[model samples]
Target: MVQTFLPHPPGARLALEDATRARTGSPVQMGLDELGTPLSQTTFVVVDLETTGGSPTSSEITEIGAVKVRGGEVLGEFQTLVDPGSPVPPMITVLTGITDAMLVGAPRIGEVLPAFLEFAQLGAGTVLVAHNAPFDVGFLRAAADRMSLPWPRVQVVDTVKLARRVVTRDEAPNNKLGTLAALFGATVTPDHRALHDARATVDVLHALLARMGPLGVTHLEDLVTASDPVPHQRRRKSHLAEHLPGGPGVYQFLGPRREVLYVGTAVDIRRRVRSYFTAAEKRRRIGEMVDLAEEVRAVPCTTALEASVRELRLIAEHDPPYNRRSRRPERRPWVRLTDEAFPRLTIVRQVTPDDDAIGPFSSRRAAEECVEAIQEAFALRRCTPRLPRLARAGASACVLAEIGRCGAPCTGAQDVPSYAVVAGAVRACLREDAEPVVAAVHARIATLAVQERFEEAAVQRDRLRSFLVAARRTQRLRPLWRCPELVAARRAADGGWELVLARYGRLAGTCLVPRGVDPMPAVEALVATGEVVAAPTTAMGAASSEETELLADWIEDPATRLVRWDESDTPLACPVRGAARHAVPARG
Candidate 1:
């Protein structure tokens, strides 16, 4: 999610800067107070594309509109509607005032792409401006990628970001292009159309440039490069204020030898400053940051734009371990099979987003092929959640458990091995045969009644029936499909063996294998080897009889390519799967 923070209004910043300049004969800390910003005197084009409707998938682009500004003046413009090659909705036509008739004689996207590209790159290099550049850019990128057309690396600027820095949060809380233009005292024309918005964007930009003063910032790069402010304030005497004035920007608290101790911010100047300097105030988050503070300093902005920029910059610059700690900490659930010895193959959560828990296979392949590992390993009900209270081990569990169908928790003796099996089974049922899982509730109740545990069993029996009634309406039995196995199958950057897969095989009817184990450690055996074919079936050299001995060759191999990226070539991502996207790879 590309979140946006409103920048101080340029007008407000300009007002403050003007006041400062009037008093000190120099620019004080204003957003556009120039240090170095990319400058271009060439024509700048602010563009927008209105789709047939809002959705990118169902709706298609209906109009492309733009306005050109050059040498602080308005140039020629472009606006056209292309037949979306689909049925247009009435609501869309009503909103955009663009009817099917209007687009019937219009050009197609193929012709439109080249035209826009030509207009954007009129001369040698051109600047493309968009209020929300990424949204427009995403479309352009997707369209280009789809058409296999190369998009020129033209300079681009996102006015939304610019406005955030230029406007104070309160001044322009709403940073919509139309809202911004109106805030700038520009005419508020009817909006939601492509061309009007672009024209208004140009007007707003011109007003900002005029207020910002001469830099010949024609392109978006110039505006951005220019946005970086210069610090020219008189150096502070030791005792006074060494920190940045209470302004909205990023802050860094440096420790001895410039080590970063803590990084944080305060919305209020005196409060944030007090949090650092005052003994009582310096206890919690601020206290921690202040304790390590050798130097306290900051950049000032009228809005959170500077704050966000500085925060991200400091995080990248310092690379503080504590700062980037994962919110979703690494903690995998394990079924220990307490019955087994030290090297018990535990079933852990599948790190992948697939439904692969259905296994107690001879191999990962068998689980992927069999698709019952989830049920066998977890003992999850075929399709329904376990009944309440029944989940807690007790006498009820004993009655059901006595029948051999369940690993009961009710009585003193719970089947430890069966518990492990059922746990994996439950996971599998949920993953694959969801509806059948609910159907198994009857099976649970039936087992409970065999021991004359009628009361306890009957209550469960009723709940299971209700559950089944509810579940059948919602979860239909879908085809049991196997999730793709996209394991990276890593080898260590340094040589070593990882006993990732404890062992894959079966005991009794319940085939048991360690599900959701990290394959990286096991692949450590593969080392730097690029292609790993299954180990050759060879006569035992006596040493080969031992798993340790079997791992010797891989343990010894160093120059082998241990791991490869599962998808595109990138370093292995760890914490492999969780509630978040794009996790950092786990350290050994």
Candidate 2:
């Protein structure tokens, strides 16, 4: 009776009696059955080659042996010896037993290669297998290139790699074919001859396939990648990715309790999700999450922008433990001029329409650094306490005034009107122009460097960088926030137009206009049915700062074109020159 293996979890019955089925057949089913050929129906040509030397570039193939098998039944065999066009080395003759006398009457590789290629490529679904495939295939490819013949494209599997993955050291001493053939009790032992080794590899291949059956590698596609160093536990979960769409989308890993464990975006959902179970996924935390994951859900999108926006929204909503970035958009900090008499810079979590804010900085420390840069550039007051409308009689000035860092309006030395000049420069630096502030900071840094106070100059330089980065981010996002509605389009990767509608700096809706279709109707339909975003109460508008930043990046891409702008007063332009122009020159 022929033994049949059913796809099952670990510890389940590994074999069953099935006399009617093929020897290596299995009642296998997988989620990607439609896309992948079943292993039971796959045709594998186990091949071996004996060469004159180790390196293909310096060597010539002496002998070629291949056995074509399907479902554990031998279909045909190919065996040939090729003259090396040179005398055989004594060492090679000793190792492979192919002496000069044996090769004298054999055909040249150019003649034998064509017949071997024809036999190996029986038709579609033919895969080339060998004990050490790279060594054998490399020789064949080099010979074909030297002979000016087109090498046929075929999937090659190395039994040496497969043995390393399936046969543990305890089961076999090493991954060499001789050891593996002995361990698997192959009828044909792998001698130094090519045909003998090729026959032995066939038996080892079937044994390894049986071992992979319980690991859910029933499809030829899965079997091809089975040699990867991914753990069997993770490999078992690859079926979860088989049903994902092969397009741009967001994917969520759901735990056993159905709670989302992680969320991510990818251009090809199936390919990206499948990578998580392969050796390519190096993140330890994500591996842990995958181990506990029970299901994968996909949210297909028309374009990459839609996919990324959805990923951010899902991360914010679920607060998945595995996602460390963009999880708490509410906690992002902003630098705003306080609505006080002095109008000092303050780091705030929220903003108001009337507030003159420059950021939604990445962190409180970053916002503080930007405030320091602005305060250093201008004589803005550093004191946190609010000053009275009129200075009290006998009020003492703070130390900032002595250091020339403040205007000292508290002691009445500089009245509100005089202090207003410094505040005006600050407001200009934050909102309309940064050149004056950047120039002032650059001058200070240059002076400090001339004095050889390099450490202080470096500190000043860092502060200036923080300020410029925050300025650029705020400037880029500010115009979008003020605009009530905007429509933009970019050429999609699929030769379509990706139309996006933004309302108050938030992505209201997006759609893809298929290639050769009129995009105007899609744009009109998108705008008409998009979310009706209310006027923003803050500089960040209806969306989180991170979301606005993402939109800003997409809009600034060279491929994106502005189709419509609803608010004429708020022209989509950054009044301030970009920070790149004022980059502080490095000191000698």
Of the candidates shown, which would achieve the greatest lDDT relative to the real structure? Answer: 2
> Over the stretch 18-62, how does candidate 2's per-residue lDDT look in tens digits?
311233245544354434577889999999999889999888999
Point out where model 2 deviates above 4 Å: 1-38, 41-45, 67-78, 105-128, 141-156, 447-456, 493-495, 576-588
Candidate 1 similarity to native, TM-score: 0.34
**Model 2 residue 3 distance off true place after TM-score fit, in angstroms:** 50
TM-scores of all candidate predictions against the true structure: 0.34, 0.86
Worst 10 residues of 1 by lDDT: 503-512
Clash counts per candidate, in order, are: 63, 0
Model 1 C-alpha lDDT per residue in residues 239-296, reported as the tens digit of each score: 1122245445545556667676555555643335533342234245544445455565
The parts of candidate 1 lying over 4 Å away from their true place are: 1-42, 122-125, 187-190, 209-222, 225-588
